[model samples]
Target: MSMAGDGREPLPHGPDPEVNHSSIGSTSPERDPLTSLMEIRGSLMVFATVMASVTYRAGLNPPGGFWTDNIDGHKAGTPVFQDVYCTRYKIFHYFNTSSFMMSLFILLFAIKASINNSDITKIMLHLTVLMDVITLIVSYIVGAYEDFQSSTYALVLMLMVFIYLVLEATTLIVRLCKAIRQMAYVLAKI
Candidate 1:
C-alpha cells in the first residue's frame, strides 16, 4: 500500500508499539489552581444573581395574589396564600427571604473580594452560596406543597444530594491537605 502525499500529519492508525499511549496527552501544562478558583467564583456569582432575582420576584408577587382590602383582619397587600395556608406560607416566605438575603450577601462578598483581592472573604462566600442553595430548595418545596408526593420526593432527593456533597467535599479537603503536607515535607528534604 502507498501512503497519500497529502501535506498533513498522518492520523494515528493504532497505538504505536514503541510508544506509551497513556501519556500521549500528558505534556500539556496543568490548569492553575487560581484559575479554577476564579471559575468557581464566577459560577457562584452567576448563581447568586439568578437566585436573588427569582426570590425578589417571588417576594414581590407572591402566589395566590394579595388581599385587596383591609377586611376581617387580613391586611391589604398581604399575600392571600399566607392567610389561607399560614404554615406553608410562612415556611415559604422565610426560606425565600433567607435565600434572597444569602444570595445578596454572596454577591456583595464576591464583588468585594474581586475588587480587593481578599482571600478571607472567600470562606464566607462559599458558606453563603451553600446556604442560598439550601434555602432556595426549601422555598421551592414549600411553595409547591400542594403536591405532597412530589414535595416528599424532592425533599428526599435534596437530602441525599446534600449528604453526598458534604461527604465528598470532606474527603476532597482531607486529600488536598495530605497532598499539600506531603509536598511541603518533600520540598523541605530538598
Candidate 2:
C-alpha cells in the first residue's frame, strides 16, 4: 500500500477518552449589535417626543396670565412674553425643536448602519443625539423661565445651561471630525 493513501498514519489521541455530554447546558445567546442600537435609538426618540410636546404646549397655550401685572402696581410692559426678544426666543425654540427632530432621524440612520456593522456612523449619530439633548435642555430652560433676567437664581441656571450648550456643541464638532476621518480610513481600506 502507498504511504500517501492506505498506509497513512493514525491520528493521535488524548490521554482521556471522549464521552458524550449532550445533557450539558449550551451557551447563552450572543449580544446583538442591532438590539443595543435600537435600545439607544428608542431612548433618544422618547426624550425627543416628550420635549417636542412640552415645547408645543408652551408655545401654543402658554400659561394663564403669563403676562399679568405685578401686585406692586408695576405694569411690566406686558411681561417678557411681549418683549422684542420674545421673537428671538421663539426662533431659538424652533431651532431647538428642529435640531432634536433631525437628531432623531440621524439616530435611526445610525441604527441601520450599526446593524450593518459600521462603527464610525454610529459614533457620529450618538454625538448628534448628545448635541440635540444639550440644545433642548438649554432652550427649554430659557423658554420656560422668563424670570432669568430678574432672578439671580434663574440667571445662574441660564448661564449654566448656556455653558453646557457651548461645551457640548464643541465636543460634538470634534467627534464629528474624528468620525469623518475614520470613515475616510475605512473607505480607503475598502
Candidate 3:
C-alpha cells in the first residue's frame, strides 16, 4: 500500500485490525487519562474546601439572643421578637451552615468519582450540591419571613433536595458497579 503525500494511508475496503484498536498516542496529550482524572479530582477538592469553610462559619456563628429585659415597672409586656431582624439572622445562619456542609460532602464524592473517570457520578454529585444550595436559600427566606407562602416554598425546596440526594446516591452505586465490572473483566483477561 502506497502512503499519500500527507503521510496518511488510505482506508481498507474491509474492517482493519489496526483500526479496531487504539495506539499509544492516538488521544490528545491534554486528554491523557491521568491528566484528565487529576484535573477533575483537583476541581472537586477545591469545591469541597470552599463549601466546608462556608459551613463552618455559618454553623459557628448563629444570630439572635434570648435575653430577658425589664419593661415598665414590675409589669412586663412580652413583645414578640421581630421576624425581620431576629428571625432573618437566625435563618441565614442556619441555612449557610447547612449548605456549606452539604456542599463539602458532595464535593468529596465528586472528587472520588473524578478519580475513577465516572462522569455520571460527578454530575450527580454536582446536581446534589446545587440542590442543597437551592434548599438552603429557600429555607432561609422562609425563616426570615413569617409567611405561610414562604414556608411552603421552603418545604418544597427541602423535598427537592432530598430527592436529588437519593438520585445522587443511586448514581454512586452505578459507578461502583461499573468499577467492579471493569476490574472483573481485566482480571479475566489476565
Candidate 4:
C-alpha cells in the first residue's frame, strides 16, 4: 500500500495501470511480420553495399571496374581502359571509392555507438547519415557527368547502381532516425 498523506486509510491493492515491463516503444503492437522482414532486408542491403564497395576498393574486382588504377603503388596490374591520364572518370572513381570506404567505417562506428547508447554515437550517426546523402549526391553527379566517358550500357548501369544505393541509404537513414526517436522517448520516460 502507498503512504497516505493523512494516514487515514491504506489504498486498495491492485495492479498499477502505468506499470510496464519494457521501455517505451519496446512493445510496439504495430510491428508486423512484413516490417520485420523489411528491416532484415535493409540490413542485408547495407551489408551488400559495404561488401561491394570494399571489394572494388581493395582492387579484387573485374577488369575495368573501380580498381583500374595504373600509377605506381596505386594498383598492381596495368590500367584497365588505358585512360590513366587522370580524367573525370579517374578522379570521380577515386573520390567515390574513398567516400564509400569511409562511409563503411562511420556506419560501423555508429552501430557500435548505438549499441552502447552513448551520446557521441548519436552525433556520429547523424554525421554518417549526412555523409551517406553526400555520397549519394556525388555518386549521381559522377554518373551523370562522368558516365558518358564510357559506353551507353556502362553509363546506364552506373546510374542504376547509384540510384539503388541512394534509395537504400535513404531508407536506412530513416530507420535509424526512428530508432533514435524511440531512444529519446525511452530516456524521457525514465
Candidate 5:
C-alpha cells in the first residue's frame, strides 16, 4: 500500500499492465553494442594484417621488378623501378612504407583496445585507422597505375574519398561541440 521506496507512487492498479519488467535492466546479447564493436574490431585487425602483408610485398617486389645482375652500376638487389623512375619510386616507397607502418600501428592499437577498452587506446585506434586509409590510398595512387590516364582516374577517386572523409569528420566535430555546449548550458541552469 506504501509508495515505492526510491521512485513514484505505486500504480493505482498495483502495477502497470503495460510495463515490461523483464526488459527494464536486462540487455539482449545479440544487440549489445560492445559485442558488435568487438566483432568489428576483429575484422579491422584482419584487414590491417592483410594490408601490412601487401605493403611489405610491394616494397620487396615493386612494379618494375628488381635488377637481376650487377650491371650498369646498378646493384642486383636494388629495385629497377627505383632506378628508372627515381622521383616516382621515391614517392611510392614513402607512401607504401607509411601505409605499412600505419597498418602495424592500427593493429597494435586495435589489439590493445580489445584487451583494455581504454579511451586512449580507442582514440589511437581511430587515428591510426584514419591515417592508414589515407596512406594506403596515396600509396596505391602513386604505385599501382602504369600511365597518366589511370593515375588521373585514381586521383579523382582519391579526391572524392578525401572530401567525403573530411565532411564526416567535420560533422562529428560539430556534433561533439554542440553536445558539450548543451551540457554546459544545462549545468549552468542547474
Candidate 6:
C-alpha cells in the first residue's frame, strides 16, 4: 500500500506523526505489544477476580441452593429452601479458584513483560497457555461431577477462557513478528 502521496518509498517506521499526543503517549518505534496487552490484562484481572470469587462462593452458597440452616436440626423440620437432592452435587470449586490464582500470577508476569520487554515474558506466555489447557481439563472433570446444567455452564465459561488465552498468544506472536521485521529492516539500513 502506498503510504505517501508521492509514493517514493515509505519510511521504515511508516509516515511521520506530524503532531501526536494521546493518553498512551506516542507509539514507540518498537510498537510494543505490552501497551495493548496491559489494557487486556487489566480487564481480565478484574473479570478473573470476580469469576474466581463467584466460582468458590457459588459452590458454598449457590443461588439455587439458598436455604436457612435450621439450628433446631431435625427436631424442627426440613427448612423451606433445603433440597436434600440439590445439595448432593458438589461443584469443583477449587478448580476455578486455582485457575483464578494462576491467572493473577500470569497477569503479574504479563505486566512485568509489558513494562520490561524481557525474555521472561516468553516463559510466562507459555505458562499462560498451559494454564488455559489445565483449566479446560478441570472444567471437564467438574462436568463429570456437577449437574448437567451446571456442567454445561462451566464448560462454556472455561471455553471462553481458553479462547481468550489463545487469542492473546496469537496477538503477541504477530506483534513480535512485526517488530522483528521492522528491526531487521532498520539494521540492514544501518
Error of 4 at 20 (Å): 3.5
Candidate 2 lDDT trough over 10 residues, lowest sum: 20-29
lDDT of 5 by residue, 1-190 (tens): 5655866665476557788666555655444445544766778889899989989999888878989999889999888888888888888899899989988876775576535443334444555666677777777776777687757866897889977766765665666566667778989999
lDDT of 2 by residue, 46-146 (tens): 66566556555655543222445665653644444435366656655565666557655654564454454345555666566666666666666655665
**Clash counts for the predictions, in order:** 0, 0, 0, 0, 0, 0
Better of 1 and 4 by TM-score: 1
Pairs of residues clashing in candidate 1? none
Ordered by lDDT, highest first, the candidates read: 5, 1, 2, 3, 6, 4
Query: Candidate 4 residues 106-179, lDDT tens each?
Result: 54553442243344444445445455545544544553444455656766675677677667667766776777
**RMSD, each candidate, Å?**
6.5, 12.7, 9.7, 13.7, 10.5, 11.3
Model 5: number of clashes? 0
TM of each candidate vs. truth: 0.60, 0.54, 0.41, 0.38, 0.64, 0.39
Considering TM-score, where higher is better, how would the candidates rank from best to worst? Answer: 5, 1, 2, 3, 6, 4
The runs of at least 3 residues in candidate 5 whose Cα sits more than 4 Å from the true structure, single-residue gaps closed, are 1-37, 113-120, 168-190
Using lDDT as the yardstick, the better of models 5 and 6 is 5
**Model 2 lDDT, full chain set:** 0.59
Best by TM-score: 5
**What is candidate 3's local distance difference test score?**
0.58
Clashing pairs in 3: none
Model 3 residue runs over 4 Å out of place are 1-30, 63-150, 188-190
In order, what lDDT does every prediction score?
0.73, 0.59, 0.58, 0.53, 0.74, 0.54
Model 4 RMSD vs true structure: 13.7
* Best-fitting candidate, scored by lDDT: 5
Error of 1 at 184 (Å): 18
User: Better model by lDDT, 2 or 3?
Assistant: 2
The TM-score that candidate 3 achieves is 0.41
- Model 4 ranges off by over 4 Å: 1-23, 26-77, 80-85, 110-116, 143-190
